[model samples]
Target: MTASHGNEIMVVSGASTGIGAATARELAARGFHVLAGVRRERDGDAIRGDGVEPVILDLTRPEHVRALADRIASDPRHRPLRALVNNAAISVNAPAEVLPLDEWRRLFDVNLFGHIAITQALLPFLHRSHGRIVNISSVGGKIAMATYGAYAGAKFALEAVSDSLRRELAPHGVQVVVVEPGAVRSEMAGRGAATANDLAAMMNPEQRRRYGGLIEAVVAHSLAFTRNGLPSARAGAVIADAATVRRPRTRYTVGRDAALLTRLARFLPDRVLDRIAAANLRPYLPRQGT
Candidate 1:
């Protein structure tokens, strides 16, 4: 076993499941003291282990965020913060016009503003330690599909925020990295499908006529993409590497699909990308009226 990274800490939010859970475990395995963030006591209990301490953290909750900051600041060990992985998110897929404004706000609340809240709170400690910040993004961040406006909107905004923050923090010895994973097999696929269907049911007749089939296609496509996606453990390792590497890249793309999609987004025109997206979704579209 490698020597322990005594008193060095890594903070990972959304550690209850999926990539967040895996990344928390991976960091602990790598010898860093990991503060894993979950939303409930039961989740915390489930994830607690050697070198891993689970904290109740729901990003949308102000009290929870403040409590975490206080805990870090007052730690008896006074561990230096090595990295902060912002991984909490909600997966919602619906047409732009069909998803209510409240839903859009909710998505941004968890996916974007929550991360910002955590980042802003911990930045003081990070500046003291010159630690890294890893934002978990997605392929959707770079390319919005037919029904991904809200989800991608937040991610795309995150990408832009990471860019500006990276430049702003570079001079201060902090490094900001974005990890865009195409798809990693996780519970999110199922949850997202449910969200999509729920939203589809609520759509007005005209809106359903326009987008009902499209919503079904997106859910099916999401499930298939996750089926072929990277394993959460592998994705976690990639993220751990991003957090701990001495000379980390500004961004890391997990899985071949992420690499391919990001590369295409960089080079392809909108029309071409549209056709490509349509082609991918074509197989999943519902057949007309049975």
Candidate 2:
């Protein structure tokens, strides 16, 4: 713990990599005591720094979640947690019709349920400090595209939960904010591409005959899009701002693409948006009956 680690504490989930890691570094640089939650001891060690305290936190596991809350509550030197960033999430890409129910459940387990569970566990500390809760969402939260349905669905639910939480916690002076980002450079994009390929590879003969090539092309396009995304550090800067700003907005759009797509979602009709989105897949769409 650094000199300032005693007074103001910020807990960031998924701090081992990507935006979460960058946010931990940024907040520590800004003089806030950052408790970075990672899944492994090695990850915790990797993120340790001047004002950052790395702790093992695996959202999918109840014991891990409980231990984190207990550790913070028991520590006399650390109290009144100022912020909680729910950034730990997994991306599973597949067409909704072909996606397994188990995968859907797993996605929600980490992206939605895990977030709610952690927030409930930490509510007491947050109330003591009138703290903020920043939920990391995505443009997919606003617009659902083909092949990314499962990921989008989880984000959509998160948006709804954040809305309800914000209103419910208003009287208690706890701010609940949603940070919707567009394509930001991170491991998630690469993982998404790999998952897409894996899913396609796992398809049965009939399923592969129907959608394999299309899935491969979509994954390639997704990888390219990710390659052009904003840096993770840029997103971290926005998250840090959202956490510390005196009067933070209820929702902060992080990337240029995020800002534009969110606006387009609001203005465009569903049918129009659907057509625009499908245009990209047109080339890869399989011919009828093969």
List per-prediction Cα lDDT, in the order shown: 0.92, 0.88
Q: What tens-digit string does per-residue lDDT give for candidate 1 at 82-191?
A: 89999999999988887899999999999999999999999999999999899999998999998788989999999999999999999999999999998899988899
Q: What is the lDDT for 73 in model 2?
A: 86
Candidate 1 stretches greater than 4 Å from native: 1-4
- Over the stretch 1-290, how does candidate 2's per-residue lDDT look in tens digits? 23244478899999999999999999998888788999999999999999899999989888988998997787767556889999999988887767899999999999999999999999999998889999999999999887888889999999999999999999999999999989888898888888888888878888887778678767776777778999999999999889888898999998888999999999999999999887866765556674
The number of the candidate with the highest lDDT is: 1
lDDT agreement of model 2 with the native = 0.88
Model 1 scores a TM of 0.97
Report lDDT (Cα) of residue 72, candidate 1: 92
- Candidate 1 local accuracy as lDDT? 0.92
lDDT of 2 at 117: 91
